[model samples]
Target: MSIKILTILTLLVPTLSAFSQEKMVSVNGVNYHVLTTSLEQRKPSQPVLVFENGMGMGLGNWNTITDSLANDAPVFLYDRQGVEKSEMVYQQPTPQKIAANLKLLLKELKIEPPYILVGHSMGGIYVRAFAGYYPNDIAGLVFVDPADFTETKADWNQIFRTIGVSEKQIDEMLIKRLYTPLKVDSSRYAAWSEGQVLTDLRKTDFAELSSLPIPQVPILFFVGGKLEVPMERRSKDYDHERFFEVKNSSNMLRWRRFIHASSKGGALIYLSNSGHFVHRDDAAIVIGNIRMMLKAMEK
Candidate 1:
């Protein structure tokens, strides 16, 4: 009887140990709640792709893409501080700060190198900063309708001023907006709503953001054409033409310039019927493009 019990216990130890591994961690005093899925027990040869959600979004937003990609390689998704299940730390959330947190998180979690960052909207800014700060850590980058630093800043300032919003108010609004759920989550929604007021007071400038260099990695920009009109309307008349030029070109010129400067290959794909939430709205398209990119990279 003792021998039989020892055999069962030994068999169950590995299973229990695997289940005990945590999927979340705190980096630089910020809580990052991560969701990960690995199709195989062994580490994959392909680089792990980390998905970063846009402002006001959480790791849960990438469920569809992560599910599809997990079949090929390990995939990870995480919510930034003050969002979703993550603990909110009181500080200015800039691209640089976020990048630092990511690095710390990876180190603490023991995530090996050769990472591919897939960032959407403002999340792209964070990834760009990350790549610049730790160039050796990245394998590639994919931007889904990322915000143009100069353009986004100018437009945001103007809009805020026009709406009679102070810098503090704008930050607060951002925090509130992020907390409010487009779908549903009563607890998170309330927390985000209250956190906005604190964030508004801590907003930073574009100059700080512009200091980061474009990464020298294979990149793919997936633009959503459906949101073009709204994005265009947000621009000032003086900046509208230039914004339209870049937008209409699917940001080809900017990518070209960046690629040339970095001496790396990059491409852009314009999706005609999607919005800011490209992955959510058209998961199949996003997944297909990534697969294609991966195949090309293999060659």
Candidate 2:
């Protein structure tokens, strides 16, 4: 059989017995649970689009936008190490390694490439790493209020230290509070929480991350205007500016730098009404921008 036929059969046959559900793929000792949807009802000639969630969020976070995008292209969303159904290994979760695992997952699933990656927050870091390592494989990039690692690390360290919390403990607590559902059994939460702790300990340096070569893929940046600061602090004249300045100082701004650093043209969109969870705050706007980006990429 032709490779295309085989690929379709592999995907369709699995859903015949039971409703097509989440599937797990193991690469380099770690397992990732991926949620996939295709609105064509049959595979299309277009490249697949991959959506990566922010820190403490999971694959389910993409549910609102995925359906709309799937109408135009195959959409795949997956949990990162220890976030959802993905298993955590002892290995460090650096950008390079995460990108490697994603590549392996795509190949193993017979998902042909030319990927358009849409990443939110820290997920942008992974997307950048993927584009750097496999430039030819990526067609475009959409960064939605992505976290700046250099800025994040500096601020995060201070916040944790001030609370007298170790980084490991902070990681665990964040995962538990944000990702773990209230109904989850205690045993599963414990296992999941511990895995996240190990994953945090395996972090890579932001400087090493920034030094990687930038890919020539079409890029888009979406910035959130709503700032998450203390109520008392909002009265300060410079609070909001300070908030954005630090954010711009981080990796996203570094990404903006990469855009200017290159000779190619790109796009940027500002979502003034939204917060850090821009997708949740305004799915229609985010989805519309993605559609516009996809169309621009075709040009």
Candidate 3:
């Protein structure tokens, strides 16, 4: 696949509303586009299911997962400050800032918590930060192929070595996949760069949350077992599939560490048929596991 394809797939802006209603809500002098399902199915005591999208992704990314979940509970999806209909921010947005903004947005909308926060990829970092900052507001957490801050160049190189890829080749592949620029509009580039900055700063960014006591909420971590990368993101220079398989092996240890830190009922589920976008690749599994968690919580 070409860079054009990669650009389209990676930074998909929301042009369509996938939920029952789409509206803009102001929080801290900025407008954020939000999509919500009907509230009729939700009870006063029930926890709201809130979803956070991956880097450069819009609320629409959760369309399939939320559609199935709408009947079970109220689902909330929103674009961050720089994506979709949301206003752009002048300052760098860290997970902590995003979490704080989300809290204000929820409060302004009168969506009272106990919330089940489901985050995919980079969004996982934000959800984790939210739970840390406001432990009382969250009931459970779901991380779908989350971004691992502890991942290092040495860890990646070790995984690539399993596929017989030399250090130089591994470095090259990493640069190409990570640092290469996509041919897109300046605005999209700006939005993507902001997210990239936060990812790069992940190790030191959530320091306050890291210092605080870990939230003991029920955590569900989904680690994708399949090696699934878009053709555009893959190179002909190496065995990308084999490399991804090895990388997934390395990620399992990290995912396990995350799940183990949560409450007794937390689970680390491995889906062999899924990829990084586990919710998209295997929506049934994502929906089923989340439904089970919700049911258990309800009991």
- The candidate maximizing lDDT is 3
C-alpha lDDT of all candidate models, in order: 0.63, 0.65, 0.75
lDDT of each residue in 13-90, candidate 3, tens digit only: 232322365667776667788777755456877989999888878888887788888767888888988788787876
lDDT over C-alpha atoms for residue 102 of model 2: 85
Candidate 1: Cα lDDT at 65: 81
Stretches of candidate 1 above 4 Å error?
A: 1-22, 39-45, 150-205, 228-252
lDDT tens digits by residue: candidate 1, 142-175:
8888765433434544455554557776676556
| Clash pairs (backbone) in predicted model 2 | 148-251
Misplaced by over 4 Å in model 2 are 1-21, 39-45, 149-205, 230-241, 244-255
In angstroms, give how far residue 203 of model 2 lies from its true place.
11
How well does each candidate superpose onto the true structure, as a TM-score? 0.68, 0.69, 0.80
Model 3 spans with C-alpha error above 4 angstroms: 1-19, 161-185, 202-212, 230-238
What is the C-alpha lDDT profile of model 2 across 97-123, one tens digit per residue? 778778877877777778889888778
lDDT of candidate model 3 versus the reference: 0.75
| Whole-model alpha-carbon lDDT for candidate 2 | 0.65
Q: Ranking under lDDT, best-scoring first? A: 3, 2, 1
